[model samples]
Target: MGQLSRPIPLLLLFGVLVLAGCGALGPGFFADRSPRERVLLLDTPFYAQEDYQCGPAALAMLLAWNDEALSLPALSDQVYSPSLEGSLQPAMVAAARRHGYLVYPLDQPAALFAELAAGHPVLVLQNLGFSRLPRWHYAVVIGHDLARNRIFLHSGRQQAMEISARLFERTWARGGHWGVVVLPPDRLPATAGETPFLAAAAGLEQAGQWSAALLAYQAALERWPGSFGARVGLGNARYALADYELAQRAFRQALLLQPANGAVLNNLALALAAAGQRQEALVVIRQALELDGIWRQELLRTRQKIIADQP
Candidate 1:
């Protein structure tokens, strides 16, 4: 945990928000849902690099769990935090580069928690994120346990440390349904150019600089409108800023290029809900849930929550 300098403002804000009694991340107060209920899981190490099929594969698993399967999101700009240890612990900036994922470069663990607040997952190269693994391993985030506050985590250890979502919440604030990292063989390029735009987006996003990321993505889109990467990242950036209308527009644009993509739909629905279109959001998310399949636990939760909130 270096200088939480980047997330100072967000750390301050998140602390106040949580302390002010804004409910923790989870199902609604109205719902009778209990932590006893199951959540989805994605098995990726906290800080993996080029060989990190687990993280990307876990993302694919989440979509599959939702009954909505598609190629992995461009993943070019999405960010992650990692736990590192020993001589194997290369810097996050360098590691993220090697993996072609954006690294926020904040050493402070508090900053890591802030990124969690924003909906991206963290990756550990060495053995960070977890205080101690029963058997040494990495984990991917799939869901959270608000009541317990742990990350509902899992990994590839001999027995695996499947535990409460709150357990991982020590440095991770927002999380849900984590465990069971279903994976395929090696996928994704081991490394690529850290696009200037990607770097700018990660820096802006990490510092709670949503407006800037949104603007940068918008600018990037101007140069490459059909860029799935730019559009998807723009949608997320807008959602973080609470500009749901624009966020939905961006996600919808991405979907146009890759129709029936559940991840895009899931996020698009979120943006719609934030913009005060709950009913429509529910409709869209339900469609994604259907695509993910009736057995998708994560989408099921999201669908049930939206339906429960329906007027």
Candidate 2:
């Protein structure tokens, strides 16, 4: 999708210190229990990484689960860096977005389980070796069995590689606990928060995928109707698509949430102007200018444009 070009020597698939045996499968493995223990194993497809193409393999697996079929070779070409012998995280994210899929990060270990419980596979970065001598790798977490204290993964050349939850946490933490789930724009991650979800949607918008961003923003609004960020994002996406009226409606919703948010008012005024409501746009911009926010300068410029359009 031309989202990235520079090579990033991040995640690679190579020799990792394979622990002799799966550690103790007992509650003592790691002490964290939620309301109830459940076992969830997703039917995620596996694509073994050839050489250092773990990034493409993991991304392809995620896309396949999302029903967007893409060949490993094509994915490698898009995300793999031959010079670096690995794929950059940016390239992996961009590749997913290019296929109309949203990549949402699983910020914590809990978020990974949450996604798995919600029937979503998470692509994760791990340091298979010690922090001092790191062997960075990418893998897809397909399932988690709390009762068994094991996490299932489609990683490297293994179809159903099982690792103790304790080891998984150690490795994941060493890799900065980086994990992401790829899904359709309409779907929301089970553990999604308002700010992060809106930021992810904004990624699509910033990438110039306004339609996808609109769907993402709509999904965010469905989950959090009162989120000013979601509302503003929805308006921005609509505006980008040239749907001025709908954009104005979204901005209005945001204004209701925080009336004095000059940023929202600026957006509303801009949408009003785009819809040919010059007088209303001027009025809104004036209100925005009277208040104080980071958009004050933009509000002043907006007023100038609106007044300059008068007869």
Give the lowest summed-lDDT range of ten residues in model 1. 1-10
Per-residue lDDT of model 2, residues 1-311, tens digit only: 11111111001101121111003224544455351265445578888889998889988998888778677788899999999888878888878877777778765666776777778888889989997998889999887776778888999999879998888888887788888888888899888877666666766765678799889989987898777777787888888777889988988987787888777777777777777787897888788778866667667776776667655
> Please, what are the lDDT tens digits per residue for candidate 1 over residues 38-60?
33334322322233344443343
Whole-model lDDT for model 1 versus the true structure? 0.44
Find the candidate with the highest TM-score and give its number: 2
Off by over 4 Å in 2: 1-30, 35-42, 304-311
Error of 2 at 129 (Å): 1.9
Question: Model 2 — which ten-residue stretch has the worst lDDT?
Answer: 4-13
Most accurate candidate by lDDT: 2
RMSD of each predicted structure:
20.5, 8.3
Estimate the lDDT of model 2.
0.74
Clashes of each: 42, 0
